[model samples]
Target: MTPEFGSRRTAIVTGGAKRIGACFVRALAEDGWTLLIHCRESVAEAEAIAAEIGNGARVVAADLATVDGPDRVIAALEGMPPPALLVNSASLFELDSHDDFTAEAWDAHMNANARGPALLSRGFARAVPAGQGALIVNLLDAKLAQPNPDFYSYTISKMAFAGVSELMARVLAPQGIRVNAIAPSVTMVSGPQSRENFAKVHAMNALHRGVDVDDLVRALRFLVASPAITGQTIAVDGGQRFLSLPRDVQFMES
Candidate 1:
């Protein structure tokens, strides 16, 4: 069914063109929510996804790394109802070590992964009407809690987002807006990796398996639907958060 203009409840999903972000868009589409799917580059992919969903799913292209990007996204919705849900799923993941990390690299990661989400959430909060409720879900990494020095800049940026989630949750609660985060480990992305490597990462957790997209989708739905839950970070990491893997074990033993 097609949503009447400005009639259906809306959701803004950053980085919704691909990967886990696309999964969230699909799930919300199935639930009949109108969507504003935001992407940085992937224009063709974003358009294709909007066409596939077909319930008034519109694509907005914006580089979240820029200071004005989030405002651009909000401005694109001028005639429509403000979004009731905002999913901050767009992130940059780069491998950087302390020895090699540069100021430029750190800023790039922080701009996309941390500052972007905070600004987007701030915009979303401003759009919501008084006494009405809204939800914001920030995507995070399970390793933020564990502190992996391998992905130094990425980890630090995600940690910043985690803090953003909590601070926004408390600050916006009075406005009836709730903010929370989801941290997932070893989830498959749209990238190339050997099966052996994939299996090794999957087995790093206590459950000996990685958290799937479905697991994350369920957690997100729960957070959005649960009114009492706020300022919490749920790690859907198969118990990886509780135990640290041995440094020598890169892959599962044959």
Candidate 2:
């Protein structure tokens, strides 16, 4: 028989302090999922979320950019039941042009966006019972296919993480653990965004609409509830993936 919502089931949401991560935390909490919200520097924000969620959530701070960051997060959950859900929402987004790229910048993106998710998923899989099932939802970017030159390192790292989602799903399926990803396009905001800026971004998509935090939350819920889907990425970008880019100047001129 399936267990109750808040019975023994737990979810670990990395970077669950602010922005998209915090949205996931609140949504899961409302669904009666006990959450371990991990944050790197948003301790006060994390605390606020924990308090807001009351009994359904708690917080843990870990720097996912370091080698031991994932370990520290997993260690914090030692006494609880193995989390049935792992949301790798914690990531680093930085701008790096190819001409000015540095190893340090590349490494930072790889460590946080790619390596951190891979390691956290690994740890969560190990903690689950041999025959029991688990789910991992990785956060990805909508431009994963159309690589943005402006955010060079960030784009590359997210691409690597998308590959990790597929690889993990294939390897862990036999154990009943499913892995999937959600590629959202400008769903959450870090600061005040003017209507003009919003309209400009919205105009780039096929739907002529911008994604909101609720859209991402719905995608997460669908992935968690669907038992047959695995190793796939759902682009919740209002059909932006289908949009085509203009040809180069020479081609256009021809």
Q: Pick by TM-score: which candidate is best?
A: 1
Candidate 1 TM-score, C-alpha based: 0.92
lDDT of 1 by residue, 69-132 (tens): 9999988777765578899999887766889999998999999998988998898889886766
Query: RMSD (Cα, Å) of candidate 1?
Result: 3.3
TM-score of each: 0.92, 0.90
lDDT of 2 by residue, 1-254 (tens): 13322266789999899889999999988887788999999999999998999765778898888889888888878666557899999888766678898999999999999998898889888887777678899999887755547667887899899889899999999988999999987665322444555545654567877789899999999988888889999988887666643421111111
Clashing pairs in 1: none
lDDT value for model 1? 0.82
